[model samples]
Target: MFICPYCARNFYRAPKFRAVSHIRFLNASPNSPAIDVYLNDRLMFRNLLYKYFSDYVTIPSGTYHIKVFPSGNTVNPLIDKSLFIPPEKIFTLAAINEYPNMDLLSIEDVRHPKIPDKAFIRFGHLSPEAPTLNVVLPNGNTLFSNVSYKQITPYIPVDPGTYTIEARSSSSDERILYVPNIRLRGDRFYTIYAVGNLSKPPELQVLIPLDGNSYIGS
Candidate 1:
């Protein structure tokens, strides 16, 4: 008795759920070990590496204890905390910083006020070594500025077309990444993540995209 907007398919039975929410995990720590995510003492995600983002998983809305441990080890947890999830919402949980100084940043993902014939996007700063950044368009307009590590911006709408996105250092105007010819389709949503460590051999930063429709019930 429900229709899937992404697939445009109708289902005879209502999707299983009473109160539900979606959650995605992002590993932003540059030097942290591969991690395992647990919900209520049960393993939920295994072997999530640095700079990786996991697809959204649906869960019933409630308060749950969350734990992050080194892969394959449960005796020691890098993070042990409890979080509350409200019904029919989306969230992104990011693990950040080096061990012993590690932390979690919980971001509420809001989808609303969409513009017709436009694409929506948000940017996340995950590169530990990178300085505060500025996201600029070819026309010299800035979309996001002074975004530091572990910072995430609110969604912005743009006309559906090809664009050359430039990431620059906010302090000195130094160019970091030039992502050219990126196309945004109408009515689509996206998250662009700045990834990589500045001290690493590949000094160049990388941008990774997570399509909005990756969540099943979104």
Candidate 2:
């Protein structure tokens, strides 16, 4: 069920549930506070903290004005942008970077007609102050190479299993952090997001969230 932001009416989807699109919000800003997300002046999500993802929401396809403000303060918006949504599409919109220089990143979630036997995953660099980094496997093979802040890598398929993925300095091969024993199932999509600050508290960490393309409308 969803309330139309434009009409302020509560309604359920009928036969054409897939006729609408889906979207989820991700907060990736390292030094930012909890935020309020408004679409066309209607609050859609509130108090979304850093490094967290909101549940998927169904919305009719159209252009929308996205206004992001610090929680409880609507006087000034950190970001005001117009985004278009086509029917039957799913997207993850992420807020990246610190205030005054933040950006909205739209990552499309493509629903495959047939699910593969292997798991599909991608990596993102969201640490604002981290140097160019590499996502490497235990064998030292880099899954993603030299990714800078705000960069998102293409998805790759891997065998379903538990593994420790590491973030290393690209030039020095110095280990930054490691995420251990991520159990991924077959026929799913995921994004391994590296966020937070390298120089301060809230130190760098990874976020592995099952993507909507894997289970939405199933």
| Best by the TM-score measure | 2
Which residue pairs show backbone clashes in model 1?
A: 1-12
- Cα shift from native, residue 210, model 2 (Å): 0.6
Model 2 over residues 18-120: C-alpha lDDT tens digits? 4688888888887789999998998988899887777778888889899999999897798899999898888889998866577898888777653567998
Question: What 10-residue stretch in candidate 1 is worst by lDDT?
Answer: 1-10
lDDT of 1: 0.73
Error of 2 at 94 (Å): 1.0
For each candidate, how many residue pairs have backbone atoms clashing (under 3 Å)? 1, 0
Positional deviation of residue 165's Cα in model 2 after best superposition, in angstroms:
0.9
TM-score of structure candidate 1 = 0.81
What's the C-alpha lDDT at position 70 in model 2?
91
The per-residue C-alpha lDDT of model 2 at residue 191 equals 80
Evaluate all candidate structures by whole-model CA lDDT and list the values in order: 0.73, 0.80
